[model samples]
Target: MNKFLLTFKDSKIEKDYQENKLNTLQKPIFYWLLVMSFTLNLLKVILDYTYYTVNNQSWMNVGFVILVILELFLACYKKQYIKYALIISNLSAGLLQINFDESNTFPQEYYSYGSYYAMLSVVVYFMTDFPYSVFQVFIHLSMKIFFTTIKSHRIDMLGIILGLITNVFLVLTLYICDWNSRRQFLLNLREVRWEESLPFIIKKPFYLFTYKDKNMSFQVNRAYNQDFFPYYNQEDCCGCNFRQFLRKCKVENNNLEIYLFDKRNEKLDFDLVYQNKTHKFDIRVCAIGLDQINYLIILEKLKLLTTSYIPKQTNLRQKIFQIKKTQIKYQHQKHFLLGVFSMFLYNNKEITSINLVDVLQKFSSRYFIISKSKIHIVYSDRSIYQLITYKHQLIIYLIQLFDCLINNQADPHSGIKLLLNQGLYAIRLKIYLTNRLKFQEQYKDNFFIQEIERNILSEEIDERLEISFLKKVRSAETSI
Candidate 1:
């Protein structure tokens, strides 16, 4: 009874229909049917050319066939107009055939068309929907039966009755087959839907899901959302409000009461805490039924990376370089600026690059020699490295660089090449420097950091540095 009346009794099938999910297999079959329709209509016109012309109905057949051909052409490209094309073609062709051989009416050619309703049902079966198709089938069958009875002047249009039975049987067979087809289609469609987004569910993973049900406060129809969602449950965790799972995961943020009732906001701001990172999401409340609403929260990770930067009148690089002279404290200090490894030294202050940062404390006329080109200075209050370099140009470069770190008028170019450590690339200026808070943040980088740190530029610390380092350590020990 259900199949006869409603072709798709399954809720999922109905949903797939609403979503317009045509399976891959359906396309080739539909196109083939369209071609077959065009060819058959054209062939009939060609074969019955004499007959139509003799009756002076040649233009009528030509125009009617052209309409079907035009409709089929449109249907091949534009899917939305297909149902109308199918309906129009089926009815028009059937009605035209009615007078063709009115005397020779049979079950196969019921006064004269090959079960138009049955053919319509077959095409409908290939479509993405069923309710409209079923209604159309019912109306068509009913009209055919009524017309047949009126023309025959008897209630026994048993041939049309047989056609109706064939259509119903065909629908029943399709309904049964649709059980699996709908399931596969839904699974594939769902993956495609979420797998594609922020507008889709790709970038933002589902944080929470709630649908209203009187028996159950709500139902959780969550995907395996552990990747984006902070909270993970082994079971269906339904409750009031959206963040009920947050409480279960021991998240202490307030408003975690989780509303069981449906809310009507398409884009409400929501927050999530997963992997100890706080994320903001858009709450999409989609009501499925009058009492049933589905809440899907997705975490937009890109919002952070793509956040609009506050436009400033001055650029960042220019502002950073333009330090206030008052804050600089240049004080005409003749400090050694280690010019090796792209490192910037203030009387040993802050430096950042894409290399080793050698921060040194107060010292004067220090001879720091890595090479004629290398200025490796790693000095601290705890572990001080003293340099003794005799190079005149190196001395000038160091003095100029030290001034550059603090003074506004100091030249950054100073006619020298530089390389700083990425730690990324983390090498050692000193053990104390390695343990600093700034370095600790990225201490967990690749294994290359520890390797690079163990060996800071093999050629930079050669014979000159070894001798200088030895002498300084000895002097420090004696002073201590």
Candidate 2:
């Protein structure tokens, strides 16, 4: 059972490590594609306009204009902006072709027109996943150069040479950048994998040590052996000098053993027993059932090594406390003004125009103490409001209130009162499920009534007050 639990724990850690790596990659890929696509579309529009002005061609111009409108609509309509960008660019490029007949009087010029296409090729290089962009750029540029030479009715050696040189340089640069990016990404992944695997090593007996004394001090020598340890034999003479130290001791199977030596070199007479063989060393010590000791030592070393590599994170308890404090401050300020200020701000105005950010900024500045906390407000109408608070209590209270509202039993005006009076049995039912306790034992009797009254008095007044204010004053209109 213990082995199974350890395996499960290891699997969980591995899963978390993989998830973090994936998340890290996701943001960079997303932004790279987004910026690349946006730039490409802008460039396409410019090129299309310039081409039409230069060649007096209306068909390509019309087609490009329609594509631009479609791209805009697609960007706004789809939540996956990068995917839309990919689709739009692919569609536009697939339809674009250069005429090679000089008689047409509007054949695509290699340098003047193909340069923009080359720029688009670079964008595609960065945005695409693999050889798709590479092959596409190669084909597109080659075809453009071929058509330009054919239309000029000559080799067009200058244009061909320039095009070849530019394509070579662009492809080489992109290849190097991609290789370096992928190499760095893999290195980071290896580090994450190593960290996730370290716990397994800590769970086993992987180190041996000995201690020697000289002049009321001791010198300790420790040897670590594991499949993962690469620097096991680097210690000189297998010992380290220390002072102001006493004898070293450990307990095994409820028995304690202490080592005392007259000189620092005297403690070098021990052996490590492994695989049914004894390996004698100058200063060797064997430990049995000392898993906890090894774990502590490994943990201490890991803590020191990772201090500079890992970022410091705020504890969840601290975050909750800060959010609660901010909520309380907002409550007090609202109470002092009797909800008049909120009413004045949101009175008969479109909720969309209320400028949630501006309100949060003002609130944060006014209640300076809670300025550091993050606040989020969720409305039933799919609108999210946010503020920063200093404590988690307010968030907890709001979450409970929101839960009741979601279940369709709590009135916003007198939230806790309505919930207690009508939802007492329901609240008790929830408490039983949440606390894993019998409803009869926790509520005892009629305790729900008192809870409702207490909660009603403490519930924040922002939502109901804002709605009422919006309904009453008709002149303070805001735009959506």
Candidate 3:
């Protein structure tokens, strides 16, 4: 036998050998079936009483009603004892209804009703997990069969066959369903255990602290990408315990940061800290510089490296970098911003390129006229350029450049326009610098520059850019 099977057997042995007796009440279904059985028995009692009343057996009618009232009281008050009460009530009522007198008896056909009652008892037994009630079902069935065979004088072959077949089928069906349910439950338990062990293998790098104003209606939201944080496989990850990993995370000022290393020699920094009265986390740094597509390629290569059957190689870094380059090239061709313009056209959608260009031109004209400075809008779909000039002499040529350059077909000048407009907006708004020439005299009387200075720092700019791209990707995925 397999070692795993031996472990399961050991567990079973421990469960069986243990003398501790915990409460084993029937589940909700058992209660429901019991109530239904009671209702059926009550109807049978009413029918029996009517028959006896018409035949002048008034004494039997009173006794039957008293027994039913007692059964109902026990069902309500002594709920745990209801199962035994039901069995006694059903058997007593069944016997009274038959009124089997040797001097005067009913037809053999009337006795077949006992088989239906027996089958119902079997159903209730199967629904319940209570060991005592389960044994009672077998005893009840045996008694019913004995009485039924004796009452009919000759054994009713049809009744005997039906009873045996139903018992076999009922038992088999219940056993299979129970076994399958157990197997699924065990599988789910294993999956949960694996999930709990994930954090150890991933070895998070940094914690991000966030806070939200209590007066504000909105709250801060943070998310992590699964591509960078790959699912941890149980076999390898199980060796690194989660509790130990958390201890080593080195918490400082109620903040914890951990560094994770992948098979490609790539490093990821994760930070965990309290924010908005709740724990917030962030991936502070990633050694893998590529975007989503490139990240996936590295992950695949790492899988091969980590697997036991694969031979380890010292040239892994070179192989990973090659894969990253291929992925970058593929993404540049497929998901480039310029490619979006073609996608819109191919889908028979109106291009927003012209609308964007018109908006920039109008903004530039208004700003130039108001300030008496030539605000040149030079932009492209990817880059934003602006020439901020006071009295024909260029003060500053703000170039809001894109990190990634791609070929765009629509409005061949879109990239140039994007760069120009972004620059114009930055300068007009005086986003970063406190003493920019355009905003120096006019904004000196205002507190906007002071506020902007506080808000638009270099770190804030990088965060905003990253957040903007993340939002765009998420929104695009939803639209698709």
- Using TM-score as the measure, which candidate wins? 1
Q: What is the full ranking by TM-score, best candidate first?
A: 1, 3, 2
User: Which candidate should be chosen as best, given lDDT against the real structure?
Assistant: 1
After aligning candidate 3 to the native by TM-score, how far in Å is the CA of 281 from where it should be?
11
Model 3 lDDT tens row, 179-253:
554455456555445435534444432211122235321111221222222221122232132223233333443
Question: TM-score of the candidate numbered 3?
Answer: 0.33
Error of 1 at 470 (Å): 32
Judge candidate 3 at residue 450 and give its lDDT: 22
- State the displacement of the C-alpha of residue 159, model 3, in Å, after optimal TM-score superposition: 4.4
Error of 2 at 328 (Å): 49
The true-versus-predicted C-alpha distance at residue 392 of model 3, in Å, is 39
lDDT of 1 by residue, 282-357 (tens): 3332333233245555444412111122223344334334432225343343232123211212122111221112
Worst 10 residues of 1 by lDDT: 471-480
Candidates ranked by lDDT, best first? 1, 2, 3
Candidate 2 residues lying further than 4 Å off, grouped into runs, are 1-55, 68-117, 161-173, 203-480
Number of clashing pairs per prediction, in order: 19, 16, 30
